[model samples]
Target: MAITREEVLHVARLARLSMSPAEADKMREQLDNILAYIRQLDRLDTADVVPTSHAVEMGTPFRDDSVHPFEEKEEILKNAPDREGDFFRVPRIIED
Candidate 1:
């Protein structure tokens, strides 16, 4: 699972990266270590274990996205640096 410098350079080229020889060497070592760790994980016996989606037993922790009307439109508009009739006035981006 050792990643070579040539392979690293090929990957960098495909990703449109301009890498030095030193960077390629560093990445090669890092990627080799990662692959070695994955190999260690592959050696573990998982014959009786069920694959889990979450590491912890969990609940749905998200809040509901409920739409609410503006209570005080004037309050929000007061803080704007540039405001129109009822909305924030931004610079005209589109050409006529």
Candidate 2:
């Protein structure tokens, strides 16, 4: 499909662009070339192409799910700058 001068002017106005008379002609030609390329692409045969969700096959690796408690809490808390009893204490965060 070929884009018209009126179409370019209307689109430019909608996009809030201050296009001069020379710019409108240049934009019309550029848009027409892009549309012509799309028209050419549309003529390609893609009937045998299979639709795929992913470019490559995907799967999660097998792993046994397990839960465990910390063996030495005091040893880990020794590196903290601030601590309150059995837990680490930090400054409060206020989002504006």
Candidate 3:
């Protein structure tokens, strides 16, 4: 399947691109080569081949999730500029 210069220009227009004649020519050649390669791949025999989601198989690398209670609440609260009892205090942001 050969790509035409007009097709390349149309795609460029759809993408909101302003291409010079030289750039359009280059893009058309590149698209033509890509389509030619796809045509070649279409001729390959895949009757016995099994389809796969990825080229390589992989295992999940994530660790099991667990929760633990924090032990240093008073130590962390020492860095707060303003505190109200057990929580950090900030200027009121909501209006009634």
Q: Considering every candidate listed, which one attains the maximal lDDT?
A: 3
Give the C-alpha lDDT of model 3.
0.90
Candidate 3, which segments miss by more than 4 Å at Cα?
45-96
lDDT of 1 by residue, 1-96 (tens): 577889999989999998888988889999999988888877889889899889897887997899888899899999999987998998889878
- Write down the lDDT of every candidate, Cα atoms only: 0.88, 0.88, 0.90
TM-score of each: 0.47, 0.45, 0.45
Model 3, 26-47: lDDT tens digits are: 9999999989988886788988
Instruction: Please give the TM-score that candidate 1 achieves against the real structure.
Output: 0.47
Candidate 1 local accuracy as lDDT?
0.88
Candidate that scores best on TM-score: 1
Worst 10 residues of 1 by lDDT: 35-44
User: lDDT tens digits, residues 1-96, model 2?
Assistant: 498999999998899898999999999999999898888867868788777778887796786787687899889999999999988888888888
Ten-residue stretch with the least lDDT total in model 2: 60-69
* Candidate 2 residue runs with Cα over 4 Å from true position: 45-96
Residue 83 accuracy (lDDT) in model 2? 93
